[model samples]
Target chain A: MKYYIGVDGGGSNLRVALVDETMHLLREVVRGKANPNTLGIQQASDRIQQALREITEGFHEPIRAVGIGISGAPKAIAEKWLRDTVKAVLPFAEVVPSSDEEIALVGANGERRGVLVLSGTGSIAHGANDAGESLTIGGWGYLMGDKGSGYWLGMQALEAYIRHEDGTDTRPTSLVERVRQQCGFKDRFDIIPWLYQPAPDSSKVARLAPLVLEEAQAGDAHARHIVEEGAAELALLAQTIVRRLHITQPRYAFAGSLLTHPTPLAEALCRRLRLPAPPQPRYTPLIGAALLARLTVDPV
Target chain B: MKYYIGVDGGGSNLRVALVDETMHLLREVVRGKANPNTLGIQQASDRIQQALREITEGFHEPIRAVGIGISGAPKAIAEKWLRDTVKAVLPFAEVVPSSDEEIALVGANGERRGVLVLSGTGSIAHGANDAGESLTIGGWGYLMGDKGSGYWLGMQALEAYIRHEDGTDTRPTSLVERVRQQCGFKDRFDIIPWLYQPAPDSSKVARLAPLVLEEAQAGDAHARHIVEEGAAELALLAQTIVRRLHITQPRYAFAGSLLTHPTPLAEALCRRLRLPAPPQPRYTPLIGAALLARLTVDPV
Candidate 1:
């Protein structure tokens, strides 16, 4: 049987999947972080090789193509290394190496023809048109952009708490109390050390997003305001993508914990974007990568 | 003849001054960073000791007291260590230990009875009343507060640049070209590695404040708006201190490069606060520390 292999390499972990021409998942394996930036390109390559060997061990099928979507492997050097590694494993297979975001976008839409708004620790909007033109908006990370992201919401909550303490914001917010409880802050100044002691951790700050959402749902005006602002910023991202892509009634899919789950932030974002509902992703990123691999060998 | 010693220890450098009873500066010495947070308490103490020894070398007059204002030496342990270090250097002298901000406030007013607004890499307003009652507001650092600080301004500039690049912000501003020229960015995505590669440096971000100020003065609408917002926040800080202290017309002094220098940000701040002009500080923070030392020995 002819087969295609897909690999999803992220910062925290890696996933390898094998599928037939029909796009049916035949085997899948998971491993540790395979991000070339974090784990040197050599180590990342080794991990991918091991995963490929394991996934293709029992099957005597010829793999026509291999697709890899790796975080921090978008640069030319890393991409070259990835392609070469796949070639060494499956000499006859065509290699299609892309970024994790690209594979996710394609996977989320089940094709290369929709917009995907991701609001994880950071936020970004990626869209592709039928003509193969693609555009990305936002995703400037925690410092510059990521306006409607988890980090942004959590930061807003903390800012509100500080303003409340300083009497600079007298708008009244339950966020002060909620954040204090969540962080176990005995004193308001405790936040100083918590944030700055070992350097600001974006993931740690993003974790507070859920509390903000909870407070919003509990009818806290301040929290609700924060959520609305975040939603509006996120909506702007999607709107900007739709306009730039010139896609009418574009299919929008949501990624990240804050958007995939049912929450006030998600609801507000959908309402602002006029999305009736969050569209379900047709396939996992792994499957999407496999499809991309198949497309490389047999163009449709 | 009797003398008082004042030491100002900061993240970058340390300044020590010897003053007579009349607060006349006698001898002064400068050294490297003496902040206990960056340099351990022992090393910080050693730096202070070396500076003190040099400043008092030729003066045989009895040293009545020593005043010190060191960054990150506010904790009881660090404070106690600082006091002991001073006592060890001049056993007969009384030791008065306080934070850099407190000393700056007293130094700027030449007494512990006015408000001081500082807007460097971070921002804060600290005030002291005749009753010895002191209040502090808005020194939450870059993440949570420091709304009107240089770091805040630079961050806003970068955010604007990103928005402008992504076509999210259509506002006409010269910040894009300024930032590009300043950072030597070939592509907009170059900012990603610049910010996240070696971790976000608040000081490096703050270094961009001047470009924003220059653009604001040159009549860039976006840059002006950012400056105005920053100035408004700073004015709020001063106003809050005034109201809380019940000082009908308190003496206000500005510190930090952004405020101490003549810039659009400083001008807007003075205008918003209704100050005829930026008030000149009566003494430097080192002299303020000496004054505090004097106050400890002879009240009034």
Candidate 2:
């Protein structure tokens, strides 16, 4: 019997799974901060090897292949770390390492042609064709271009408070109360000194999306407007990626935790695409890696 | 006949006007950055003296009442600064100093019982009844609260770009191009380093209100929504202040360069207030200050 391993490394957490030739998730393990830049190559490799050994200790069969999908892992340093670390741990296994986004797309729809829209700590759209060609639209990170993502919304709320507080822009949003509370802030003036303190985690921003969506759902005009606009933008990104990958009427599967929530965004995507939005995929994109391990595609 | 001087000291510019007893402006002088905090008290004081000297340099007559409206002058420090700063320069002039917003309100209306909404590099709403009692709504400053102001709008645009670029928030706003051009920022990642730098003026944020309003005017949807919200918020503030000031049917006077643009905020305020939108006053708020300076009123 053959065995396989799949790993999905993201901004906040890392997920790993072991499966037999049949793509079922036999066992899994989770860890914190697996980004090579964050944990350093050797340490990240050690963590991965330790986790994998703990999960698949007594499987008598040789490992077929191991696939890793990691955020911020495209850097040569990251890739090398993955290769060296995995090689040292599971010396007998073939490892196919890729971006966390890439595996998310595969897991979202399971080898079917589709677009994957992801929004959590950050936002990006990735799609793959029947042929391996893929493309992306916006995934610039919080500083430049992750519109409608978690970080964007949080920062946006801060902006509104500042404008209102500063006597320049006056837009009342129900999210203000939550925003101020979450930031441990009382008013806009505190933001200058506070934001200057340190580089906060990218995922911290997404926390506001749910509150904004709930307010929108509850008939807060500002929240509703924000969701509608955010949806339109997510749709634009999905559509752009679809066009880029020559995916006509592709089945898109959303793979982010944000997608699981009933945001106007996914609903808007369905409306924009004129296709029924699939219920959140039954499994996570990490499973896509397991499925990859279970595949019979001839590697010619 | 007696004469007096009124000065509007803002972050970027200063306007000093000399007026005769009937509140007629004789002449004026303009300069820069007289906010004691931004430009130190010495530097700002020098500019203030320069402005007063330029406006009444050759008059050779003592001004009966000199009312200088300075921006960023908190009440606690207003007295000491007024005693030392203004009096130091114009020994022959009686210096009566108040906040820039208060002076702007008096400037916007020749002599009226109502609310004055000032939106410039910052925003604040202050209202006074016939009894001389007053109340304030917004105008916390760039760090805490300044709703319906320019700085808030600019901050919104910058955050939108960051969200979009990072792929966290998926909303697409016209802010993409506007922020790029305004900040000359190349992309989302480019902002990471710049965000760590030191910036004192919140006026930079206020600068984006017009740009936001313009985009809304062009129907970018999100931009328009923000403008509408901004307008509505401004109206709410006006109404709040009006209620607090106990003026039932007061004329709503608005000042600030933002009013010069085609902002729906005024209309929104009209809608929110359920009152016909008043015209931009016959004279700017600075002129109103000139009127107050020329005529002395001591609740007789």
Candidate 3:
């Protein structure tokens, strides 16, 4: 009996798994970051290779296939490098490569035919219809897009705090105090220096998203407005994907901290999107990658 | 005859003028940039001193006073340093230091009152009422504010182009092709790399503002909306300053490329913020600085 290999190369960590033909997980291994966009291709490939080796150790039979889903690795740029690296590691196996978003979609639905909306440090809604047409919206990063994301919420909170400090804002918000307490800012305007630093970290800003939700939960109209607006933006992404794919009421799944965490923002998104109910992912991204590998080798 | 000096230390260049007691200009000199906020205090001071020396080279009479309106020099931080530096340069001169905004107001109205709205690389509305009370709105820089400025218009244009390329934007615009021709971009998505560089230059992005105005002139609905929104925001700044300062029909003056340039955006701003007519600045910022110096020496 031959096993299959699947890798999920994320921004923070690299995850690899060995699975049987029936999609049963045999073993798993995790390593450091492998996001090619941030971590150069060489480092990402090294980590991917390391994870694969650890996962397939002690196996005599050559793996039948290997599939990879890497963060920031679009098909045009990452496909060749990822395929060659996987082949070098497992000479006998066929390789399938794709973007992390695609993997997330395949993983959540156990197939590539449903929508996956993510609202973590950034946000995007990606999906493909039965006709194999895919569409994406609202993943334009913090500077250009990523509306209704954690970074967006944090930016909103910061803007509000600034307006309040400026003494021009009419809205009453405890968000100023909450942010000061959370970030340990001695002065209100201190947030400016922190934000304009030479290299502002997106995740550090995204972390502040919780404060907005906390204030909203406590009935702050300003914070509530931010949440509602974010939810609407996310909903627009889903609606756009569905309409463009020409799909009728396609199954939708959620991913990332902003959506998965306990917050009014997530609930508001659900309500605005008019989703029938909250849906759970059917399988892990690794499992989905393995399934994709199986499909690549044996297309029915 | 006693002479008063006024200096306009701008972001791009320095202008110094020797004005007599009656505000009649004696001699004017121009030099390189001396904005202390970006150029260190020492460099800025050096440039200021150089300009002063160049302007008063042949004059033997000790200047009676010096007034400076400098960009990036808020009174709270720049007061002591500027005063000390000017005193060191002109031993007998009484020195007055003020922000560029204040100087702009003084220069535009030939008085210490009325609003001065600027829309250059960044945007801000600043002025003082009859009561000597001053208010400032916007000018939060490119990252957080400056919503109605040239940089903002450029950013908006780029966003529109990206969205249009993504096949998600509802509006059809030729801005994509225009931006490509103007920016020398080979691929549609090449803007991503340019924007996400290690230290993205705000001025470079701001330089794209003219392109937006060009498109707007040709009657692109999407471009028109951006211009209108920008105008409304600038109008809000004027309104905020007017209401906060408790002035009725305060004389409003415009400065910077977004306002000074002949564009629909400037026209829109003028239309949205109704006034008697387009008001010209009574004097240059350097003259305003001299006037301020005179006021310091002789109140009222």
Candidate 4:
């Protein structure tokens, strides 16, 4: 009875799964963040090692392979660390490591042949073609890119509020009052210290995306504009991937809170991309990693 | 020969000047950053103390007053720190502390009247009226505002580069190659690591503004549009201050690298504001601080 291990190492949390040869999930373990960029390589390795141990604890069947999909894992250092950690834990197991985004793309399509658009704290698009070629677009983080992301929407909302307050905006927005209420801001200047208290936290800012979406659904013109612009930016990402990959009528899957959670942004993005509906991912990233692990040792 | 000391505590460096009762400069000393926000309060204080000791060395005339104009000094804690630091350094001297912007405003007009528009790493407008009432507009830092700032322009350039690369932007730009050359980017993905090396530095981003302006001057439609939009945003800042203060035909002054330097952006801004030329400041900020120091003890 051959078994395989799959690790999904995200920025916020880590998930590990043990599966049989037929891809049947036998056990699972969840732990803290394993993103080397944020958690440090050593800490990420420790988390992955601990999760692997817990998931494979009682199983006596020799693990055939281990697949790790970690955030920023595509970097050589992170990939090396992941491979070394898996090898250390499962001495006889073959290791396959890739970025968390890659696993998500594979999981979304149940194969490596579709486009995945993710709009979490940051936004990015990844597509894999049948010819074993993959392309990425717009994962530039908060400072450089992340267009149509939660952080981007939240930033637009805050900018609108400031423009409205300063009387510099031609288009009036209710964001001034809405943001004030949402952020519990007593004075307009309160936002300065709040934003830069220590430094800009992308997650904290991303948390504001829901408010902007809610306001858009509530028929606020400015909020609706922000939502539409964000959706358009996201659509551009998907379209660029489709064009670059030369994939005709590619299946598009959505990830992240803004896209996955039934919202106007998702609808707007689908409309822009000329899709009838948002495609659901076939499996979770951990499952996708398991399938990849199976492919590592038994490529069919 | 009673002397007054003026401290101009900027983000990058500090300037201290000794002036006579008539505001004649006697001696000057330069030091490292004295901004309490960036440099610790104790370190900023120590820098000020050291500058004071050095400037007053071999001088016998009793120091009458000290004026400090520091970045972020308008905040209560920062202001208190400045006061205490000055009092400690010059026990017999009266201390007058204000924000760097306030001192620049005073120095630009050489009085407590008129508007000063500064477009450095961050953009802001400050104006004072006859009734000693002052109004501030649009100094919301890099994330929230700084709409027409050096950081703002540079960020726009980077965004344009990404959009152009991703084929998401409608407007064509020379920024792709220009920025690649200016930043020495080996590959497009190199920008991501460079921008987030540790965290986004506003000054570093602001340094890219010149390339953007140069591109605009050299006939890049997208770059020109960015410059025009930036100038318009800055004009809005000045216009808001003018309207709020109800000061008809207010004298305007410019400061900071982007504005003070002869650049197309400055010309665009002046054109937007309908100014014939950029107004030069009547005195430097350090001299303005000395003038304020004189007014603190001898209010005439």
Q: Enumerate clash totals for all models, in the order shown.
A: 0, 60, 0, 0
Candidate 2: where are CA atoms >4 Å away?
Answer: A1-9, A13-98, A108-113, A129-300, B1-3, B17-20, B23-29, B40-64, B73-97, B117-126, B133-249, B252-254, B261-300
Candidate 3 structure quality by residue, lDDT tens digits, A201-292: 77888888999998999998999999999988887788788878888968888888888765798789778777655667888777888887
Q: DockQ for each candidate?
A: 0.76, 0.08, 0.43, 0.69
Candidate 4 chain B lowest-lDDT run of ten: B72-81
User: Considering only N, C-alpha and C atoms within 3 Å, which residue pairs clash in candidate 1?
Assistant: none
For residue B128, give model 1's deviation from the true position in Å.
Answer: 1.3
Interface RMSD, Å, model 2: 6.7
lDDT string for model 2 (B259-282, tens) is: 644466566556666666545666
**Model 3, which residues run further than 4 Å from truth?**
A183-189, B184-188
The runs of at least 3 residues in candidate 1 whose Cα sits more than 4 Å from the true structure, single-residue gaps closed, are A75-78, B75-77
Least accurate 10 contiguous residues by lDDT in model 1 chain A: A71-80
Candidate 1, residue B265: Cα displacement in angstroms equals 1.0
**Pairs clashing in candidate 3?**
none
Query: TM-scores of all models?
Result: 0.96, 0.61, 0.95, 0.90
Candidates 2 and 3 compared: the better one by TM-score is 3
Clashing pairs in 4: none
